[model samples]
Target chain A: MHIVDGALSNPVLIGGGLLAASGVAYSLKKLEPEDLPRVGVLSAVFFVASLIHVPLGFSSVHLILNGLLGIILGWAAFPALAVALLLQAVFFGFGGLTVLGVNAVNIAVPALLVYFLCRWGLSAEKHLLAKRVADGLFLVFFLITIWAGFALYQLYQVEGGSWSVTVNSVSLILFSGVMAYGYFLYRRGILSVAGFWGFLGGSLSIFLTAVMVAISLALSGEEFGKAAEFVIVAHFPVMAVEGLLTAATIQLITKVKPELLHAVR
Target chain B: MTQVLGEVSRSWTLDKHQQTQEAFLQSLDPRVRLLVCVLFSCVVSALHDMMALTLALGIGLGLSLFARLPIWTTVRKVVVVDSFILVLVLTLPFTMPGEVIFSFWGWEASREGLFRAAEVGLKANAILFSLMALIGIMEPSVLGHALYRLKIPIKLVHLFLFTVRYIDVFYKEYKTMRMAMKARGFVPRTDLHTLRSIGYLVGMMLVRSLERSDRIMEAMKCRGFDGRFYILDTMKSGPRDRIFAVVSAVTLLGLLAVGYL
Candidate 1:
């Protein structure tokens, strides 16, 4: 997901830089001096978390965990991730200097989105409301599934099933299957409301991040369109894996130290 | 787990050892180095001409040599970064519509696409090599202080400092926890059980770290910490830093002229 230097257009790069700077400034204003230690500590934890690569079939994928970060840090996720990205670029050369802003925006915006979308559903006290929200979220997912089905059909008619189209169709079907399972569990009272929200937040954040990365690439040039589509298709497994991991992590946090979920807010 | 820990520690600790070495790049003021790196990267990324991009890459190699970066290790790092964009570089030639260079299985590889791919590869490597030389070798905390002096938000800098300080501490904590899991006959695989175990491990780490932070906050408060960190070592740019800056600016401008002409 780290777009290298020179891959992006000038306008996209500048726009990303401006947006990230403002996000850092705004989050800094909201951050209390005393809260610095906690946020910093959590930020370090996230940096380590990203280093943890979980197995997926014959290969392994490193954890992004931005969804869990958003659930924990809220707006603070932006600065924490920006600092992390900067560190990665400087020390590890995982990303480039000029494209740091674009990379941060691609990763952090979904984190911010998940923070707003999932924060309220994290409470057991709001079980009913959380359930309602989860249902509404699944409703949105159902609509997306329908839309994806149509898109897949249209692509098949036009392009007759390229690699990207196959991957897209298969992943969307897999995702819909996962959503159906979650909806089933929620209805059966197998998954708690908070767990359900965690599942949604985890997967939704990754999905959005993948989409944003694709958009940034596609917007950069016409040549990048295929690569951009491949980017989104490739991240489907990551989204599923992160979703389950996030749900499990949230469940553990709620059981061990519930306040950690609410600490940032 | 041990290999991962070793890699992390190596990346973080290697710079400290280099800081003690009498390298030319290390002698320059970090703020000047930081500014020059950002400027150089910005200029290189905008260049499209092949000759200019190659020249920019040569300058990056020169910077790395002056910095006295470990040759094989620096090359390996640059190669690793190039591999990240291997997909983009490979696909560009076939994706763009232009004069057909060759056809493979009915897929046309265009001349324009191949050139674009080479340009991207060159630009990315040039920036990466220079960036690693100038900024990557700095002590992480010193980099944070440089950012602070450069008028970045103090809170963000503070956060950066605290994070740099504790990444090692938490990684140690993480290693111990993973050891315990290993002792319990736990092995990770591509399964829900593995994901759940890792997730639980991460949650446990976060809980422990938060508790540790509370103790850290109390300890600092006892020392009468007023949220301000005093810099005992002042950063003063000397004559050498001035010369380096001037030379770098001229080289960067020259690269820009080459790009346009």
Candidate 2:
């Protein structure tokens, strides 16, 4: 979810813009000559993915794929997603040009986190269980970080707003349940050989979607419980579907070219 | 899904309504237009007062009219594009703390929220309309050239051009894959089985895309391609572009002054 032009306060915009610029600068410096085409191709993939909608019951939602991009491209996801977003702003006006920097950071930062936490374990093919655990841990940790009021402060200046004990406790329980389910899938040996990859992918999709919705609503000044209700409850079905798709995709890749996973790591 | 695909492809079409319209905005230098648009958006963002926002919006509307862009369609497009922002505005009245005009279920519509929402709405609409009137007139190639001339990094520009050029090709590939899945009796449902199949579809697309990228790299290298991308459209900022710049700057500054009052 993008914060449109003039929607955010000036300070947040400038701060986000500067941070995003530095991330891009670092990415550019880190990029090798051989990596240019890969980055460009992945950029096109990300751009096209948004156009492919996944049908929910009545309405459909486009794919974000930020997590997928992060796992594959690492820091390169920053520049890659940034270019795709720039085009989205120019062609469709889905996001404003002025807010491009902040929008890029909002999506790409989590991707970096995914890369840092999951890279080693995922690369070690022997540690499939470790990879799933890493993904689950990172996701739950990520949710806790956001739901703990960090997003409310970063995105909006909402004061005197507290998550009701009831809402917080409920969300915490639900999130833990998700984490436990992910672990169960890993242990049950669901899909034979790379089932855990699918689990990781699905969990990442759900985690990213929840975080995106929470921040978007928070920035719009919605209270924590309301945002949580919409993200956790309203988007629950979408999360489940997204996870399954993500897992399947990961499984296919692991079957066809398992080295691709190791390559990114 | 089909609707979104069509809309995405349609947005990239080179020949649109803005091309046929012979307007002053169409004639301005692309670089100047880009700069002015950025400056205008920043100015709009800075203004807090509705009076100033309304004045800014008036200028945007005037420019759109002068450019001969269809008014109704432009308004419709702005509304559609800013739907999320509109939703944010909807929350303002009930969420913000101020003197309440209406209260329901413990939520109050405060004057401050209403005022803030209007400020955001006016600013957002003004920026969108102005962008449509100004930068929307130029071709993507021309805009890429302008960005190059404006000293944006060459690699960034190259990445942008590649993404734009190949998006259609990849979209076609994605559609074909989806069609193949459908042929195989795949129906997307809320179940894990269907979701897994869709995942295979996405993975298959990525693998193909990566392979295609390698081929593209080889082709480019065969043609003696370098890291630097050369912009074909050579645009120079002439006196007319300068005039547009001066006029726009003066108008924005004047609005800023009025906003301060």
Candidate 3:
């Protein structure tokens, strides 16, 4: 979700701007001069990839592929994603000028987090570590789902019922189930270690991006609470699609061009 | 699918052909244009008064007219942006608690929420229109160079430039692969096969792009290229740029005064 201009408060805008600028600077520092071509080319690849709309059902969804970018580019995802976003804003008017920083942070932070959380699993030797990480994440999400279920039940009892709350809680529980099934598949050896990590990173990045977008929106004003919740719920399908796509992509990359995965780091 | 491809190709080439046309914004100094765009966005986003926001939107529309941008295309793009914010705007009236303006399905739509939504809509449109008029007309390479002159990090600028340079290339590559898949009778649908095939396509593209980058690196090295990139086109602010800057500064200040006081 690209947040349009003027929706965010001044404080949130400034904070996001500063954070994004520093991220770009830090990533730039980590970038060696020689690595420029590779990073830039991959950045272009990502930009084009985002333009590719995958048929979902009646409608289609464009690939964000931010998690795959993170896996391939590591720290470089910040600048890569920022550049892509700027191009989108300028060329397509999809996003605006002022909210660029906030949008960048919302999309790229999850990418960076994915990089940190899943890079280890890319190695065949780290299969055990990958399995453990997947299981741990599954347990964490399971616990969260249970806790949120209780809270939602309490909310429903108190407020009688609200459509937004019901939709939100149900989607979240469904989302957790999706994650658990993904992990279950990984644990059952249906997916390779790298594929599992790819699935995790892909879906997790989208999940986190949706959450961050929601937080940014809700933090701006109390009136945005409903819209913020709706944003997360709307992204559930995208998360599952991206997860499966990333898993397949990572599996292919690991088989054919494994060096590309570690090229940036 | 072909319509989507056509749209992508058209948008990519749209401004390039238009750049040859003598437009007011195309004639201005890129750095001034860029700075004014950023300033306008900042000021417009900060403005809360509906009157001032409306004025800002007028200025935006006026600039687009002066820039001689395609009228229907510009309006269509603005509409696209509005559609994106529609969710937030539509929910506002129902979500915000205030004096009820209307009741729909037992849900009260608030007057304050309606005003807030209108305000957001105005601010967003104003900034977006101005931004498109000012910066969207510039060559992306020129924008990169302008950022470099504006003292943005050189590495970031280089990345921007290189990314801009290669997006077209990779887009063509993507089209080629899509064509090959189409030749093989691969129709994209809502299925695991489609997802996996697209994923494999992306992976293949990445693999090829990386290999191409390696060759590109060697080509550059063979030409005695170093880490330092030289800027050949020096931007100078002329009398026209100076006059435009003054007018913009005054207009921005006037908008702020009208909005705040």
lDDT, candidate 3, A1-265, per-residue tens: 8999888999999999999999999999999888898999999999999999988667888999989998889999999999989988877787788888999999999998998888876774766766787778757755754564465456545645477567656666666666766777777877788888898889879878988999999999999977886776778778878988899899899999899987875
Q: TM for chain B in all models?
A: 0.91, 0.85, 0.91
Clash pairs (backbone) in predicted model 3: none
Best by lDDT: 1
True contacts kept of each: 0.82, 0.52, 0.76
lDDT, candidate 2, residue A133? 66
Q: What tens-digit string does per-residue lDDT give for candidate 1 at A1-265?
A: 7899989999999999999999999999999888889999999999999989998877889999999999999999999999999988888788898999999999999999998888888874767777787899979966865585566447545755466567677777776777777678667876667877888889888888888998999999999987887787777778778988898889889889999987775
Ranking by TM-score: 1, 3, 2
Estimate candidate 3's RMSD in Å. 3.6
TM-score for each prediction?
A: 0.94, 0.84, 0.92
Name the regions of candidate 3 deviating beyond 4 angstroms: A142-181, A184-188, B1-21
Q: Which lDDT tens digits does candidate 2 get at residues B72-189?
A: 6566677778776766677677667789898866568889888878887888778877877777655655666678889877766776666666777778888888888899898876
List ranges where model 1 is wrong by over 4 Å. Answer: A149-157, A160-162, B1-21
Number of colliding residue pairs in model 2: 2
Alpha-carbon shift of residue B43 in model 2 (angstroms): 0.8
